[model samples]
Each structure stands twice: as C-alpha cells, then as structure tokens.
Target: MVHHTMTTNSTSASRASSRISSMSRFLVLAAIVGMLAACGSVPLPPMEVAPPRPAAAAGTPTAPDDGAPLPGPIVQGRSRWQPVRWSELPGFDTDETYEAWNAWLKSCERAPAPFAALCPEVRRLSLASPQEQRAWMMQRLQPYRVEPLNGPAEGLLTGYYEPMLEASRRPTASQNVPLYRPPATLGSRRPWYTRQEIDTLPEARAALRGREIAYVADPLDALVLQIQGSGRVRIAEPDGSVRTVRLAFAGSNDQPYRSVGGWLLQQGLLRDASWPGIKAWAVQNPQRVNEMLWSNPRTVFFREEPLSEFDASFGPRGAQGVPLTPGRSIAVDKDSIPYGTPVWLVSQGPVTSLQRLVLAQDTGSAITGAVRADYFAGWGPEAGELAGRLKQPLRLWVLWPK
Candidate 1:
C-alpha cells in the first residue's frame, strides 16, 4: 500500500503536492483517450442548457453570509427575488435515494478531484444496502449543512467539458466535450455581461459593497488534478490583432461532463471514498496528502502563488499560469449559491484582475444555504498564493444565469 504521508507546517503546501499527484493520473488518462482516437479525430456534441424552474416560497432558508436577514425577493434589478421552496429545487420531491444521488452528482460536478477520490467509498456504501446508503449519505451531508426543505425555485444547472485552447496548431484527437452550454452562446459566438446590469441589482450591489465573502476553503486534500488528455482542437479568434488564434480541444468520453467523480473513477486514479471518505481524508491528511499529490508529475494543481515567486519560476511562460477568459466567470443563483461557482472574482490578491476566477465553484459537502459558495483557485504553487492573499471582499452577479 502507498503510505501517503508527509510533514509540513503549511497546509497549502501539502495540498499542492496531492494536486500534482492526481494531475499526473489525469494526464495519463487523457493520453489514453488520444491514443484510442482514429486519425486523431473525436467529434463532440453541441452544448445544451437546462430550463430554469419557477421560484417558490417555503420556510426561510439560512443566509450564506453572516446570519443576516434573508435578502428581499428582489434579485436582479429587473426581477423580484422570489423565494424558492425546497420542493422546487432539484431533489426536494425525490425519494431519499434520489436525493442522495443528486447530491453526489452535484458534489462530483463541483470538485471532480476530491469527488473522484471519494467515488469508491460512495459505491461501497450504496452497494451495501438501501439503509446503509441512506446512512452513508446522511453522514456525508452533515458537513454541507444540507437538510430537507420545502419550496420552489428556478435556475439552471449547467455542465460541460471545457477544453483548453492551445496557442498553435489544431490537434486531431479525443478531448472532453461540454455536456451543456446555454443556447445563446452555442456555435462560434462570444458571450458578454454588463457591469451596468450588475450594478443595478440590490443583492448584487450589496454583495459587492460588503466585505469579501469568506467561503469554506477547499481542503487541500480534496483537490484533484484535471489532466488534459488528447483530443480535437477548436480555435477561437486570437487575442489582440494577432494572426494566430487560440485553439480549444476536447476528448471523447460518453459520460456526461457532470459526472466528474465517475469520470475519475473510470480512469482508475481514485478509489470510491464517498462523502465520508472525502471528509475524513481531508480532515486527517490536509497537509501530508497535499504535499504528496503536488509533488507528483501527472497532476496540475490549482492554487495561487505569489506574483514574485511565479515570475521567478515560470516567468513569461507563467501568463498561462492562471486560466482566464474575458467576460467569463462562474455564475449561480443568489438563492442556491452553488459550491464551486467559477467567478471572475474581482478583488485584489495573488490574482488581481485578468481572466482568473479560481474560488467560485462549490463541492456538495460544502455547499449550503442560498448564498453559500466555495471558490476553486486552480492548482499548485500559484493557487496557494491566491488562497492566502484572498482577504478582500467581493460581490458577484451572474451574467449568464440570468
């Protein structure tokens, strides 16, 4: 058995190591996908978006921020923030089993690495028996502070395989394809969000003006590597009048992008640890496991590193250090501030401006309340810096979720 242990005073350093290790496995899987493709061609389907449900009212939900009174029903400047009854959200009416599965899927989508690592445990619990699965799920759900509720709400749950567009030359190979994309941005179209619109909404404005929201930091041990295997390269127009355009790639995996944990398990890098396993592992090995994983070559960790340090190491090559897209930030409904909601996160820290949106997405175990959330700062040294210096306050308004 692999004795995954290390001694480190810095929690962040340990996490970086674990992330690096997992990334190595992810990359290997990607390579396998590339090798299997014929003539290096893998076709992907167009992105799809789920329709938003109507908002309903039920008992008052807990506030994500400090125990402040729930925000008024006014959401964006244009629409009233109707309360969403628990019944209206995704698993309210479902049986306990379905609810458990839904939570698992949501958690997997939020943080593929940790969720993937926990997959084996989830499977074991689910396989043990119905009662066992329920018990297991309940134990898992405790950390997230999730509970049954009654109400109706409306919002979209989107999933997709985002391919990194390379700097040069399109590759003919397999790559992960996005499972969903809102109809508006499908095809070669640019997406946009307006500052004016964001400014007008009371919730958005209040969130912006208030002190930076301090989310539950993603435990370093829970971090997993997202390896870019081989696939087709799709290019978008290049930045700044340059003749060369940026290219994006995708791999062929029939599984839905939302099943991130399943994807990792199928690749065999992570065991099914389930929710309890994940929580336990995180709590126990926060520092040691992180260091081991980060030291591994197959992984690429997401974290913030000091600018000076980053500059000294990667230098000019470091521009690609943090993945950012113009006008692109993770968005979520104020009511269900999903864990891991990727956001441009406009505040000063290791990443001030640029296309970085590290700490927005939420892992299910961590996601609770209408406005609660967790941000994913990429991986490795860079991610560490951002995570440490992340003391500024920020308010976020979703551009597309609207």
Candidate 2:
C-alpha cells in the first residue's frame, strides 16, 4: 500500500507496453492500487496533497555530515539533471552486473538509439566477470543526477507487480466472474461502457457473451489484474487440462481511472489503503463488492496470450517493448530517462529497500518528474505484496553514453 502511495491509476506500465486504455501521469499519492484498477496502487499525491521538498541546496561542494554532496539543479525535460561524480552513487560497486546485463539484452531487442551499437559488445561480454563488466560500463558511461523541474534533487520510488490468480476456461458455479476480451468494435467507440454497465446492463453483458477468455471466482483478484494491466492465471481448461496463461491489456472502456482505496477512505470504511483492508471491507459487505468496484467506472479488457516455458519465467512486455526483469526493470517517465537507458537506483523505505543497477524498460502515466520510477517487482502473490508495501524516497543517476 505504501508503494502504491506513489503510483498511477490509468493504463499501467504494461498497458504503456501496449496501447493500454490511458496514458497519463502517476502521482506521489498515498494510494494502494493493483493492475489496471484490479488490486495494485497508482503513484499520485493524495487528493489536494503536495509533494515534499528537501531541506536546502547548498551551492558549494560541501561535504555534508552524512551522504554524498548534493548538487544544484539544471534544466531538463520538465525536470532537472545535475552533473554528479560517479563516486557519489552509493553501492555502485556492490550491485551485481549479471542481472542488469540480462535486462539490457531484452532492451536490445527493441534497441533505442545509441544503445543498439553497444549490444553486440554487451553480448560478447555476457560471460565475462562482474569486474570486467563494471570496467566496460565505466569506460562507456557517464552519470547524471535527476531531479524534479525547478525542484529538489530527490523523488519517490515505488514498485508494481503482476498479480496471479486462478481461473477456469468455462464459468463454474463459483468461478462465474468473467475476464472478457474487447468487443470487436471497441476501437469504433470512444468512451466505452462503464464498469457499472458491464456488470448490470443487459446490453453490455450481451456485447461480451462469447468473449470470456477465463473465469475466476474472486472479483478482487480480477480487479487487481485489471489495474496492473497484466497477470498470470492458472487455468483449468475444459478438457481438465490445467496451465498458466497471461491476460494482456487489449483495450479499456475509456472511463477515467478513479481510486477505489481513496473512495473507501472517504467513506471511513478503512484506515489503511491496502489490499488486505479492501478485502476486509469486501468480506464485511460481501454483497456490495460490486458496488465498490462500480465506484470505479473504468473497465479493462484483455487478450489471452499462451505462455511458453521460457515466457512463463519472464514478465509481460513493458512500455519499452521488452520483457521486464524483476528487481531490475523500472518504469520511468520517458521524458527524463528514455527507454533503454541504464539507471543506478537507490531507495530506502518502510516496505522496501534497494541500491542496484536497473534499466528504463517501461513507462507509466504517473511516472512523471525527473527522478521518479515504478519498480516492476515481477509476478504472483509475493510480488504483489512487495509492490503494495514498497514506498520510499528515491535517488537516481542515469548512466548515459559517454
């Protein structure tokens, strides 16, 4: 829930990977959201809340009592990029290069400018030692600190994950809730039907009669899959065959993404904005779960993707058009850290902590500002738990081509 405090409610990074329903900004909020509006949190300031600022920016290269010397801000795409010494990046030497290299290999598949040329060598060096990898990096890259436009040098770091659920090919007595594919005429419509209509309207239900890819028992799990915009469902097919498949973002109803957690907070139904709290509310008012869901008018549609043995191990494609590397792939504001760029990230918070090498392999609408990022935590329940709880102060350095 803490990480979700700074997340986006619209089309998520995975949606950003595809067309998703929406593309917007993430806020430094106190929200606990899930995929597409399903169960993950978005990044935004709470309604009417403003971002906090640093203590002060001392102009000189003053050696502070604690960490590295913070630099003054310089202009960038709606933010600031300040020159900093590589020595200032904490734990750079300690981070393993193997994980980041694998993530980079995936980035090379789409190959953003200037990075493609380095891929051949990157591959050649894949089997090299970490020390050698570090040497190559230092020889080829320069570091720059990122900050908010005209603001301080710090920002928030949060995580997002793929929530896993169980499903059945055909609806059963308990698994009646359907995850539908987009209507064939979805593109022809602008603002499509709302969540309420999809749930209660006969016409809307009829519009999706034969389009269900899989059916699950829990509405919360379904919603989490929607909000995250990507998920893995362990399905029991009609032949009694059981296997896992990915439900990707096919389209959306074009309705505005509203925060269900925030709504519950306003109604005084819960104190903590988290999946646990929301589930508790649902348990107490079992009959009104649909009511809570309808509070969010937006609806996400999915297209089922058959999973390969290898694909099952990786994540769904992200905004950068590459599979996400758990703990290594981060969703950024393309305006600041362009897709395919390497980033050195550091953050310490209540729910999560990290100091590592990562790649800008995805984007999110709410992932704006110079230093913000949404760490893709990978799939399933453990990942979702981490994503929901991870909210911390972040510091980033773009490892640019020298």
Candidate 3:
C-alpha cells in the first residue's frame, strides 16, 4: 500500500509539471501574436534571399583573411578626412584611464569650465604606450578609487528566451526561440560625485583645468532615450541639447489615443494641424472618443524647402516636380563622404527596398569613422515609419561623390 501511494504521488507531480510547461509555451505564443497585431498591416517588400549551400559545400574551408582595412584618408572640399578605427583609436577603450580621469575631475574643488578641460592631459598620457597609459591612468585614479563591488543589493538576475519576429515576413514556428539572459544583478552603483558636488571641489577643479580639452559643445543634440510621464519624451541631440517634449493629450477619459503634440510635431507627429478642434470635441463625447481618435489620419512632417532648380540627374523630385533640397538633405562627409554625398543603402534580411537619399546634415557624438552617418527621414509619420522599419544591417555608398 505504501509503494502504491508513492507511485501515485510521483505521477501526479509529473502531470503538474507538464501542465505548467504547456501554459508557459501558450503565454509565449500569445505575446508574439499580440506584438504582430500591434505593428499593424503593411505589405512587406521583396526579400533578397541568400543562395542555399549544399551539405558537402558547407564544410569547405574559406581563405584566412582579416576584414577590409579602413580605406586610406580621402580628401574633399576644405576638410581632411582620416578613418577613425575605434578599437585602434587612442584615448578610447581605456576604461581605467577614463575612470581615473573621471574620478580625478570629480575630486576637484571647482567644476572645470567644460568637460573637455581634461582632454589634453588625457591625450598627453595616452600618447604613451598602452601599458604606460594603463599604469599612469591607474596611478592617477588610485587616490579616488572606491571598492568596485561595494553597492546596495538589488533584485536577482533572471534568464529567459524571447521570440523573434521578422518585420518583412509572416511568423514561422522556427522564429520562436528563447534569446535573452539578463545580468545577475544591477545594484545601486552611484557616480562618485554629483555635478554640484564636483563643482565645489578645488583640487578636482584645478586638475581638470590643467588637463587638455578635446571636444565641448553648447546646445548638444540628444537622442530620444525613452518616453516618460503621460505627455513627454526625452531627446538627446548632437549640439548637446537634452530636454523633454511635452505633449498635449486631446482625447477624453474614454479614449486615450486622441493625442496631439508639441512633442509629436517636433518629433514628427502630425502632418499638419488640421484637427485643432478635435481635442475639445473629444473631451465632450466620451462614448465616441476611441472612434474619433482612430478616424483621423496620423501624419509625420519634415521642414519643407523648394527643390533646387538642379536637374533630375541630382535625385528624386519634390511634390511640385522640382529637385528636393539637394545638398541640404541628409548626407555623410565624402572625406567622411562630403556634405552632399548621396548614399544608396541596402538593408539586411526580409525587409527589402529600404531606400532613401539621406543627406548627412548633422554629426553625432559616437558617429565618427568613414562608414558612419545619420539619415534624416522627413519628420512626423514619415520619420516614425522609417525609424521603426530600420532594424536591419545597412550597406551604403556615396553615389554622386565617387
């Protein structure tokens, strides 16, 4: 009787485990389906499928070679362009040096006028051999060093697989696979000093002032990191501009989707303000709020300029059949790709025809090197669409400059 009872208990436990596993699988599938539905309906472009290899050919050895070296510095217009190999670049990738420099700067009694004040010292030290730089950096930072692992306890790290969905193709059984494992913990690792605290330190101030300055900017361009609050989104720009865009929520309590923007417009929200009256109307009609929000066409916008009289040989036409802002449109440096270089980009994977003539009108903090660029799709709906669709590898060439 005891043996029989133990067998029944074991069987019951196995069945319970099986049921739980089944439920987890179902939840994952549901999440995938919901994500696909949220993306809405847009016909995918033709895929450039790679040719299949035979089983015997798969094992064939290829020639041993390093990747293409950085192309030699090319000159265009007034500026000289040198290829910036990030891994090979001096003063970058030296975590200890940066940490030391940062710590020393913080220890100072006054805020260095600008962040670049320490750059020259950094450059001088970096000119030494890598080992020398490491030693020097460690020595400088040692005075300010804190225990690396000392911090407040946080939550446990978890691991799980997430399903992958292709924007250009329908979901297949193969695409659903586990993929993510987060770190074990992210504790309260604080900066050594706050800005205000750093500004007050005399030694820190003097050290920074003595150091070399590299790059400093006013009105920096900030990237949009995340949406915060109900009506604001954060922006980071190249000019060092960091701020939040406040949005105007126009929808009624019944319908939350009817929103317009100062954020939306600047970030390319509405094509135009055709529905100025819609917000007030939305507030009154709670029952029809969702319908009202859904009915209006969402639009995106970019600042418009008359296309140049330059011939169609330049590129695509504007609404009135004239050349669009030829050089002013997005472009990369030719030395980098000169200001007006037109690029044809081919994307990787299923989404095809991700074509645009992006003029490199602006630069980014991390956007250096011959291959780097910033593509500006027109603002509002157009920009949002392009940004959302731009998840694949890009191959670009300066068609006109070359």
Using TM-score as the measure, which candidate wins? 2
Sort order, lDDT high to low? 2, 1, 3
**Which number leads on lDDT?**
2
The global C-alpha lDDT for each of the candidates, from Candidate 1 onward, is 0.25, 0.69, 0.24
Model 2: per-residue Cα lDDT at residue 288? 79
* Candidate 3 lDDT tens digits, 1-402: 000000011111100000000000012222111110011112223423323322222333322213545455444442333432222222222223332332222212122233234445555653344345433332232111001122221111000111111110112243221111111111222222222232356743443342211111110000010000011223333365644332111111111111222222333433332223223333465565434323312211111112233321232221112222322233232244443232333333342333332333323222234443323232233333332232233434332210
For model 3, the stretches where C-alpha displacement exceeds 4 angstroms are 1-328, 331-335, 350-352, 400-402
Candidate 3: RMSD to truth:
26.1
User: What ordering of candidates by TM-score runs from best to worst?
Assistant: 2, 3, 1
Q: How close is every model to the real structure, measured as TM-score?
A: 0.21, 0.82, 0.23
The lDDT of model 2 is 0.69
